[model samples]
Target: MNRLADKVALITGAARGQGASEAELFAAEGARVVVADILDDPGRETARAVGGEYLHLDVSAPADWEQAAAFVRESFGRLDILVNNAGIAPPRPARFDEIDLAAHLRLFDVNVHGAFYGIRAMLPLLELGHGASVINVSSIDGLAGVGSMASYVASKHALTGLTRSIAIDLGPLGIRVNSIHPGIISTPLVQTVGPARIARLQRTVGRQPLGRMGEPQEIAAMALFLASDEASYCTGAQFTVDGGHLAGPYREPPADPDETLD
Candidate 1:
């Protein structure tokens, strides 16, 4: 149960969804967790539920990142894991040419630059652990394209690149870095895109190999593995938790004739 015993983890966007799941799971495994999010009330509640400390953080703001890192340093004295999980998808679908410039920029600010800021700000504490780990929560959009999610896809792609680059730079120092790509998980984030659209997306997902949407805990499981010593030799890897969405289009095989079997 104590896979992460003696560790300290900071998870951004921990008020809900995959981040909250990771925080709870990490705490269950005996790690001291810091839940950072802009939602003060929900964040505090999540922290209380998980026996973690809550930090108010707007990942797009550099000063917030600095404050969050400082809080972790002062509270825990060292950091063992950083989960860059704060991100925002566009509220509604828009074509490439129809997307608002402000929305696009905001998506990058939180999804891409936020991770960058977190890694830089937490480096000192992470280094203090001597063998810390970083988990960047990208999306299936990061690995492949989804029509109308151009900005989110681009931002996640940038995050994946950053993961690889930093892994190379930090590997010699004993810090492992990796990115996770989750498929359509049932989370509040889905509400932003509207129910009609989400309904259609779910129908599509149901046709995939797993034939179902994933739960937050499933992705949290991946984060836990990446953060643990079990993955000591793993770094700069892209782990996709999608339900075989990337395997290929689901197709029914042709029926075979009895003569063929004979």
Candidate 2:
């Protein structure tokens, strides 16, 4: 079904990984997708693959947003869906005190401020949209605190709050806003942690009920639902696709003492 037929979508960080997956999925669903990112080559490639357009957008830069807004306005006349999926993830988590204050703020620049910029810049277009929706790609860290990764966690939390506030603010205009929190997914960001860190991360997530990472497509599916008219009443909500990671601690069942003879 063409859930997004005739809708116009702009997805940030669509150069690769989750953003790329979202771009592909949106295009397949009949939306005129615009793959936006700072990565020039892959951004263009993703757009080409989807038979859509591309723009060089640095989410952390206000000026870039201005330009992006202009471009989208000129190209599509209005925006239907905006996915703030661009963000940075460190290979390893940083302890609270060990976290560099400035570096942490930079993480906020992208992870948090990026979403802020996207919504503000695209507000006009969204206001003129048919069934406008905003999807902020936060992480599981946004919902719960982690031992390390202080900066990343904080940024995601800020984003989550931003999502709720924006949803309420935009609701009057019929624009829906929501957040997507993903679990340890098998994305390029996950692969960059090196073999040792990868193994450690795997063990860390082993206790989750699903006992495995999620796929980018899984996250895309959730975003698609919100973007479509099916979610007309859904807003200011937190959707988790974390393989039951936020379902609380998973405890193994006790071993059976009797040998089964029956």
Candidate 3:
């Protein structure tokens, strides 16, 4: 529908996976997209394929965000959408007690602090636009607890909170903010969790109502909605696109076992 016609969007971590999927979809919907990522080669390739531009963005660095914001302002004059999608999910600790403090700190630095900087850096441009939206990529882990990966879960939870608070603060300025809680999608990061770990994840998926993982495009579709005018009233909301992973109770009692089967 060209919902994003004449809009300019900046998507971080757009080299591959969900970020890349969103970039492609946004461009197709008539938004001029800027693919930003630390991975130079793939970022450029993906941007080229989508007929967009690629910028080297290290989300962990505040200075990088400043430069990126300036680049967008000079190039596009205004920014209508910002997607904080760059993140890392390190391997699960051998045990909860084995969690490395340094690793946890680094995770928060990227997942939490990076989003903070992105929002701050783009505020000027976003406010300049008639209406703008910020889409933060959170995870289902942010909503629930698991046996391992406490640190990663903690970071996502923080991001979700940040998203809500920002939405509250920015809504008056016509800038909407929202978080997306994605369940296990087929991404390289998930593959790196190893076969045994993947088996455990599969068991979790089997119990979900949909009995499978989600696709990147599915998440992108929700993102597009949130970024478009269709979601004009959807700020500070957490949308889950997890193949029913967040939906409660897939099992039902043996129906009418004691009653007559009509």
lDDT of 1: 0.90
Residue 60's lDDT in candidate 2: 96
Clashing residue pairs in all predictions, respectively, total 0, 0, 0
Local lDDT at 15 for model 1: 98
lDDT of 3 by residue, 1-262 (tens): 6989989999999999999999999999999999999999999999999999999999999999999999999999999999999999855654557889888889999999999999999999999875799999999988998666888889999999999999999988999999999999988788788899899888778667776778889989999998898999999999999888778775432345484322
**lDDT score of residue 136 within candidate 1:** 97
lDDT of 1 at 220: 98
Error of 3 at 67 (Å): 0.6
Model 2 residue runs over 4 Å out of place are: 251-262
TM-score of 1: 0.94
Q: After superposition, how far is residue 155 of candidate 2 from its true place, in Å?
A: 0.6
Give TM per candidate: 0.94, 0.94, 0.93
With candidate 2 superimposed using the best TM-score fit, by how many Å does residue 17's alpha carbon deviate from the native? 1.0
Tens-place lDDT digits, model 1, residues 99-208: 99999999999999999999999998999984799999998889888788788789999999999999999998899999999998988887557779888987778667
lDDT of each: 0.90, 0.90, 0.90
The true-structure Cα RMSD of candidate 1 reads 3.8
